[model samples]
Target: MSGCYIHIPFCAQKCSYCDFHFSTNHSYQNEMVEALCTELKIRSESWKDEEFQTIYFGGGTPSVLTSGQLQKLIGQVKSGYRVSNQVEITLECNPDDCSTENLTTWKKLGVNRLSIGIQSFNDEQLKWMNRSHSAADGLNAVRNAKQTGFDELSLDLMYGLPNMTAEEWKSQLLQVIALNPEHISAYCLTVEQRTALSKWVKEGKLTVSSNEQQSEQFELLVSTLKEAGYEQYEISNFARNEHYSKHNTAYWQGVKYLGIGPSAHGYNGKERYWNQANNKAYMTALKQGNLPETIEILSSFDRFNETLMIGLRTKWGVSKLQLFEDISPDKEWFKIVKDYEDQQLLIETPESIVLTEAGRLLADGIAAELFIIN
Candidate 1:
């Protein structure tokens, strides 16, 4: 029921659309890797009694780690925590790093899943996004992973770019389907502040897609993936039945997990904590044997809002009984639920409150509107 996440904050180059925590500077790469191992040891002491069902290597790019580095990290996990035989170990990789040699080494090291970031299948799009790999690199990466006997492969696809025709979007989806990955996660491109994409837009060097185009592309993704026999497990994730990602699913299920390394967040049932985002600060804190994370004690209202927000994003939906009990059966909640139901945004059954497909597109707004003030 619990999981572990290790953040690897290194990338060959920063993507124009990325605002994630990472650096292309190799000056501290060796130090960072050592510090990460030290952080893992410090984080795992409390979890020695519990077993993890999933261990995710997420980040700027986990594939950047060498075989030895990867092995040593997994070794620490095995020695420090009670790991289950059925644990899903997923490594998030960039297409340029998914070589045959690396895939084979990862397989030997017990990595059960590979989530490759393919973004898009058009070279122009890749260049526009400042991605390091070409479309051919993505195709080859998938082939290499499969050739190395990896059955649990997931591909990340991006859509809703400026000047990207609907036909181009369809072609991208079709190309991914032809690759026969067990799972596909389609994400809509957004221009986040502080990113090169945002700067370019401000400077009139880049244009963002219209909201209508984004919505249309999202609809296209759902329909195309459904027709291709992939279940829309989440709003953005599609998978062949039983191939859903366990690591991410645990988050939606509100399972407790421990996160190690800089910029990582951890949740243990009632409380949540997040580590320092700066690498130098994180290393200094860990060197002093301190767990460098900000802690938050969840109030009842906080818990209710979170459950309502995250639970509604999944296919399992939020249980009506649980919701009623989690939050008081107050006039505010009752009014919110009734209003949403009247709008046909939610289906209220005896057991749960589920969002219809139409409601899902506007999920964040709906969840925000329903949030209760303490």
Candidate 2:
């Protein structure tokens, strides 16, 4: 259950809301591709015995890369690592890049899944978000992918925007449902520091939605998607017929994986590693035969806290037996769990601790509250 994640840090246009590491400058695109392959080979020794079940092309925008570049990268993966016969290859595409030609080429190259970033289908909202594509582009992208024989389609939808109404949020979900994608990842928009959205917040140019509104929208998302026959597998992910993102699911379950490219993070069972976020620095390091990465050794407390934090965010929940594998739960930890259980915020079954819908709204906070200090 190992996965490979390749980060392509090139974006044609930087969205105002984005704070992720990416550059609008693509002058070194060719060099970056070569550097990525070089890095892949450099790190391949760690997982030589294991086969990668999934390979994800995530980004700034993977769709910005050409067909030749994609083939080169995928080709590199096939040759460098032990791959599975039915490897799930996913590419995160922007709507404008999901043309018929692009989709067809991707299909031929064994790219089975398309995770299109259709943040919102409203033209006004798209402009507000400074997205590259129009609402029409998004609709056609899904149609194009389906026509090209791609069945495993996952669409990204953003909710919790500034001053959003329940009805408006409902409309967005309905639009996504009409597209009939195999998976839907709906996220709440947060104003991150240094982002334009954050600037707007500081200057009072935009007002964020109320907590009550956000809660209503989330509840609405759960109900509407459930009615549409999509299972809310994770807090933000809905899937039809269990078309889970193999790479991300493996991550939640604490499976080891390699993260290739600048700003990408990787994990074995015990340690975590992250590459340099700067593109030039990363390329320079690889060119000089040096790895531009930092490594962290996880303490027992770190492991226990992570297990509970990530495990509680999904429908599968945290296994009760595995909770104490790293360290003993302190008195306050037991008290917190008991309180949440009594409030019906979470369930304490014989085998697992699963969050109820109400509890999931406060999941991260609850997980932190229950963390044990070493």
By lDDT, who's the top model here? 2
**Steric clash pairs (candidate 2):** none
TM-score of each: 0.97, 0.98
Computed on alpha carbons, the lDDT of every model, listed in order, comes to 0.89, 0.91
Per candidate, the number of residue pairs that clash is: 0, 0
Model 1 TM-score (2 dp):
0.97
lDDT, candidate 1, 1-374, per-residue tens: 69999999899999999988988886887788888889888877677767899999999999998898899888988888888999999999999998889999999999999999999999998997889999999999999999899999999998888788789999999999999999999899989999989998999987788999899999999999989999887888899977999999988877889998889999987899999999999989888988889999987788778888888988878866656565666787778888988999888888887888888998999888888888
Cα lDDT of model 2 by residue, 133-182, tens digit: 99999999999999989999999998889877899999999999999999
Query: What TM-score does candidate 2 reach?
Result: 0.98
- Give me the overall lDDT of model 2: 0.91
Q: List the residue pairs that clash in candidate 1.
A: none
